[model samples]
Target: MLHGAGGSGEQVLPYFTALGDRLSMAVVAPTAQQPVQTTSNLDLAGIFGSRFRMPRWDLAGRDFPLAALRWALTELGADPNRCVLAGVSMGGLATWNLSMRFWHSFAAAVPLNGALSIWESFGTDARTRALLPNTLPLPLFVVHGGKDERISPEFDRESVRTLRDLGHQEVEYVEVPEGAHGLDTLGLAEGSPLFRQLERRLCRASRTDQSASISHRANEDTHGRAHWVGLDGITPQRTAEVHARWTAADRVDIEASGARRVALYLRGDRLSPGDMVTVTVNGVVSPVRFTPDLATVHHTFQNTVDPGLVAEQVIRLDVPQPPGDEPAEPTNRTRGRDAETI
Candidate 1:
């Protein structure tokens, strides 16, 4: 499974807990081999990654990521023939590219509200056609938001139409109800009919695969928030880290934005010095900082969750435990940030 733009497997996992259970599949959310800078949330464009950006999926990514995926599959002892490839945003684009490049690898491919190019179509000459015909049909699970104006849901329709025009036999298209560009954790929990359809597709291949439980399920909270299927309940986890002395001065606001990668920002969390400082947020930790003048720093962390689950939203920042004085209560703040549902 891959995440959207600005997301590593880590950041996007929480938004897909239900998908995990529905598929009854073990998941691999390896971090991107290297960070890619992107600005657009759609088409998985990175705002500040040095490693990748949109329009670079053509044999243009680092080798390590694919190598790592191979290693991971081997470690899982998974049968590559039965593997399903699914991703959102840039990851979706990656999956599309992989399907074309490694045509024989995946059993099924799912690209959620993403753009894909086979590259083979670009060339008009005979050699190019011989090298890459319109290509083979891929069983697809195409999902998108009917109202996602950012990239426009119509693009998804066009993709499906293209596949049908190419004589593809199997194509499953799902349009989320009242959906938008960044359908994050809340949107998932708000409940979508898409879940049942997704589950059907996930398990469609293997009535025999029932013995394998790729993931677990979580009980719904009072408000209907769902966690991971196999990794149920909130795991009260804690760790320690230092913070910018400057963060003490800036009021940080966390925004879920209804998409993966919880975003944290402070008007001026930057310290007087231009140094990288360590800080923790929402019991999750990160290490990046800015100078006093560069007060605005957005730290986005990803997690996968069952989109339909509901729970209290809180963020805990680990402030340094000052030696002489009593340690401050773990700073607690609440925000509405969410992991993307795509």
Candidate 2:
């Protein structure tokens, strides 16, 4: 779980101690890496605050915050598939940001009184719009106060509506009519909507790899892979996307945009353990040998630190272009190495 602005992991322990005990779960919260020196809330500007001196998640980058959370999980040996991320205020925004970017890392997310709409432009929309269909399953429980003055409740309401309109079915938005910006108070209640959502979603393993179809988008290599699929050789400063579907017992259809390489991390799911599998990239068709490498399993587990997500085999395929197609323009940015198993 992440803490709000100007807040520490220790400061939010009391909020979840009783709930964690009741649920038989351990709560691990990590402090943000950067601290903003500030005297009053007024000193901060916009949603992040001005000249912020309080410790908070860095919205501009993903390395520090992600590394911190994963390090804590690694130390505790926490089950990534069963973990749920919940946060309040600025932390609430961090929850949304991290969960969306790394959907396979957590089962569900609860963001209380977060500035959902404001962060939409900053991180959510650009990073997720292309993969919304794939991301819709990562359940969300959102709460906001109708009387919130610091972060308007109407913002969350509008964002929720937009998500629903975009076909996200598992999102739940709750508004406390009489509450204010400090809706973290409600999150402490056992009967609150956020807690109930966690009760229903937490502790359940997220079977992201079992899906028949998968879609993913990424602007950077570090955030490229999702579920059992990955996009590689993406152009710098360009977002790459890939969609794959099991069309038949032994056939997989794949389409990619803004990418030159794609990989299928396979398990025993319809196509694995077989001698040969048919792969269709764009419209080109080919037969590829299916081989499960033990080394791959070890390497994947080492990277993800989750046995449930390890793939039995990986099939690397180059994105095919139509005949007579012109090559893309070259850029100064160098491409990263091949994608690792998700």
Error of 1 at 31 (Å): 1.9
> What shift in Å separates residue 198 of candidate 1 from its native position after superposition?
1.2
Clashes of each: 54, 8
Considering only N, C-alpha and C atoms within 3 Å, which residue pairs clash in candidate 2?
A: 36-52, 36-53, 36-54, 37-53, 44-49, 44-50, 45-49, 45-50
TM-score of each prediction: 0.47, 0.80
Residue-level lDDT tens digits of model 2 in 108-205: 77888875335343334443334334457788778888787777776667667777987987788888777787645465477776676656665453
Residue lDDT tens for model 1, 1-342: 776655676777777776766665766765554334332222233232233343333222234335545655557766544567777766666666555444333567777756553221232222112211122334678777777664555655766776677676777777776776674611454145666666666676421211111111111111011111111111112111111122333323221111112222222222334445454433345665543331122111112111121112222333222356332222221110001100
Compared to the true structure, candidate 1 yields what TM-score?
A: 0.47
- Name the TM-score of candidate 2: 0.80
- Full-model lDDT for every candidate: 0.42, 0.66
Please tell me which predicted candidate would have the highest lDDT against the true structure: 2
